[model samples]
Target: MSSNSTPYYFVPGLSRHPVMASIGLLGFGSGMTGLVNGYSWGAPLTIASVVYVLFVLYKWFGDAISESNSGQNSINVDVSYRWSMSWFIFSEIMFFAAFFSALFYARSISMPWLGDIESKLLWPTFTAVWPNDGPAGLVEQFSTMGPWPIPTINTLLLLSSGVTVTWAHHAIRENNQKHAVWGLAATVFLGAIFLGFQVYEYIHAYRDLNLKLTSGVYGSTFFMLTGFHGFHVFLGALMLAVVLRRAIRGDFTADNHFAFEGASWYWHFVDVVWLGLYVVIYWM
Candidate 1:
């Protein structure tokens, strides 16, 4: 540990991580309150909240980076820290898996049963349709989305982004800095374009097809799954953008590029989730 740092290898001071985090959450909650309340200040409230949260995250991660690069963090500490982060990411995956599983079961088993002998009497007028069947309780009509155009394009975009990130990883390993930077730049651009197209799709859904969060059971699960996955995509893209900036400054070496790898894995996970969503939500 450094003379300025503590025995546990952390910065020797009363950390503001907790207090700052609380403020960020409070800002977010207040902003959500305004949004749900549908007030004039709702947009501002949410904007402030997002800014606060981003600022807090910046400071939190910034501190950790300083702690690591300042020689206070040992190799032993780094290994242990990596294990902890791995398990944490695993837990996050499990959390999302539960949601995805519920979505699967609801669409496959529950919806089918509702239109069958188990609840046929209850839903006397409802037909056993694949797309519109919401749940056993609320039998509403909703058009199912096909994997013909928008979804297929999105899937391809994510797949290509994954390939580009992998290329960047390879370039870094080979010490081809220019190629790696180009790859990162391309990945980030593709990610941005993917988001833009997804937004266009959402608008098309609301306008032409009348698909939305309140349309039916299909709409609910579809938005939840795809929306969350999109948020992850935003995060992955942001991370990749930052990595590109770092690469421009020669901040990372081939042997110590865990930051780049982490971003790649995260983007791949987002891609995988989108694939599952495409099959279950759009295809079946």
Candidate 2:
């Protein structure tokens, strides 16, 4: 392609980013394994690996952004990005589906089976309750998490963020930079607040309610679902923040704004996952 003409497809040159990223991940995995096995250098290795990963991501993303800004990304590239994101979100759905299925099995299948007459004969005092501490009473006594102030508030916050992110997408399409920035900012703010409330909820669960990870099936499922969701929210918010920065810098135009759209898609996916969690984990 000529310097003045857009390429049919932008194929980046072979780079060291993939190798560096793999090394960083390997180090992180090794560090985590060491930490679990009580190795002395685990903490330092983990921290260093995290820093290395972040640095590599920074450089890698910067290069991609530069390519986009230079008009190297064609329409074909945009379509590929959309399809890639769609498949990525579909995989995330499956990830959560596995967790939800575990919850279902524990609640609807295994519990009832254990409560049956045949199983009950083995342990006369055991009751197969939803939040039971196991037949042997191995888990600690704990209260269940309810859909109250914090959880309900978080649900509302995520729902509202969905709206705000959609509004930002509309604003971007209309070439209204100011409104887009504001909308993205509001979405990020709401996500941050939701995370803050989640932290408080976890603290309350541990300190007051005594609902911990060791509280048997209920506690483990609840924490696994909500904790993973919270992590996704953090990532979604971070992506929105980056998109917001780009918006403020007037990077996107009415014709081209896939970065903004991609971030919004992820944020919306996070919102949808939270809704499912609220219904299944909290209400059910």
Candidate 3:
């Protein structure tokens, strides 16, 4: 196939990646189930599966990188990749939507319905207010997190990182490699700082505020939302770090930098999600 012209299609040969990824996922799922059931080998098994999956990812992406760097990728391939990444991000949006929907349902509908006159007749003392300690007070008292200090700090950090990443994109487009490198490094640094603040907030929530996952619906929603977002932040930081490494190695250029673009898109999506969380979960 001509490198300059779009080929009919760039069909890859059969590979073991799909089966291997499935095996790894299965093992990981089994390990998690076992660990939840208190099995001794569960932790080790989970670690093994995770390592396997990471290794597979490394090899798989390495091959794709080699293809791209070797000029095997055409405009068609680039377009396909862009579409795939867009769809992937859309799927991620739906994933977060489900969680956000659950949060809304719990707060707006379920809580009030449970606290209403008829339902409260069964449990007379159940408070309708949010962050309550449940009907029987089985859940321990805990303070809810406010959109202050650490969370606000994280919001700022993410916003700044967005700006930095955008600057990096612009620099790359302008063929200013040095500025691109600096911008990427700053973005990664900001992401790391955001994660640090999140970790500190979690520690404070558990220790000082008595907010555990079991602390009632409020705590459950709080941790579920924030914890998943934390994971996404870490993943986005890792993605940016990879892009930064590639930038330092002169991988991306003005004409071809979809990998960097994809990472930036993911990072921006992460930032937007956090903004939603801050307003809904923190402020609201």
Lowest lDDT 10-residue stretch of candidate 1: 2-11
> How badly does each model clash, as a count of residue pairs?
0, 0, 0
TM-score head-to-head 1 vs 3, winner: 3
lDDT of 2 by residue, 166-218 (tens): 99999999999999999999999999999999999999999999998768899
Q: How well is each residue in 160-235 modelled by candidate 3, as lDDT tens digits? A: 9999999999999999999999999999999999989999999999999999878888887888888889989988
Residue 133 of model 2 has an lDDT of 84
Per-residue lDDT of candidate 1, residues 1-284 (tens digit) = 34322345333478887798788788777876777577888779778877887888778777766665565665455556667767866876886798788777876787778788867676677666656644444544445667878889988998999889999999999888999999999999989988988898788877777787777667777777787778778988998998898788776666666667777777887888788888877877
The most accurate candidate by TM-score is 3
Q: What is the lDDT of residue 86 in candidate 2?
A: 92
* lDDT score of residue 97 within candidate 3: 95
Using all chains and alpha carbons, the TM-scores for the candidates as numbered come to: 0.85, 0.92, 0.93
State the C-alpha lDDT per candidate: 0.77, 0.89, 0.89
TM-score of 3: 0.93
Off by over 4 Å in 2: 1-7, 27-48
User: Candidate 1: global Cα-lDDT?
Assistant: 0.77
For model 1, the stretches where C-alpha displacement exceeds 4 angstroms are 1-14, 29-43, 133-142
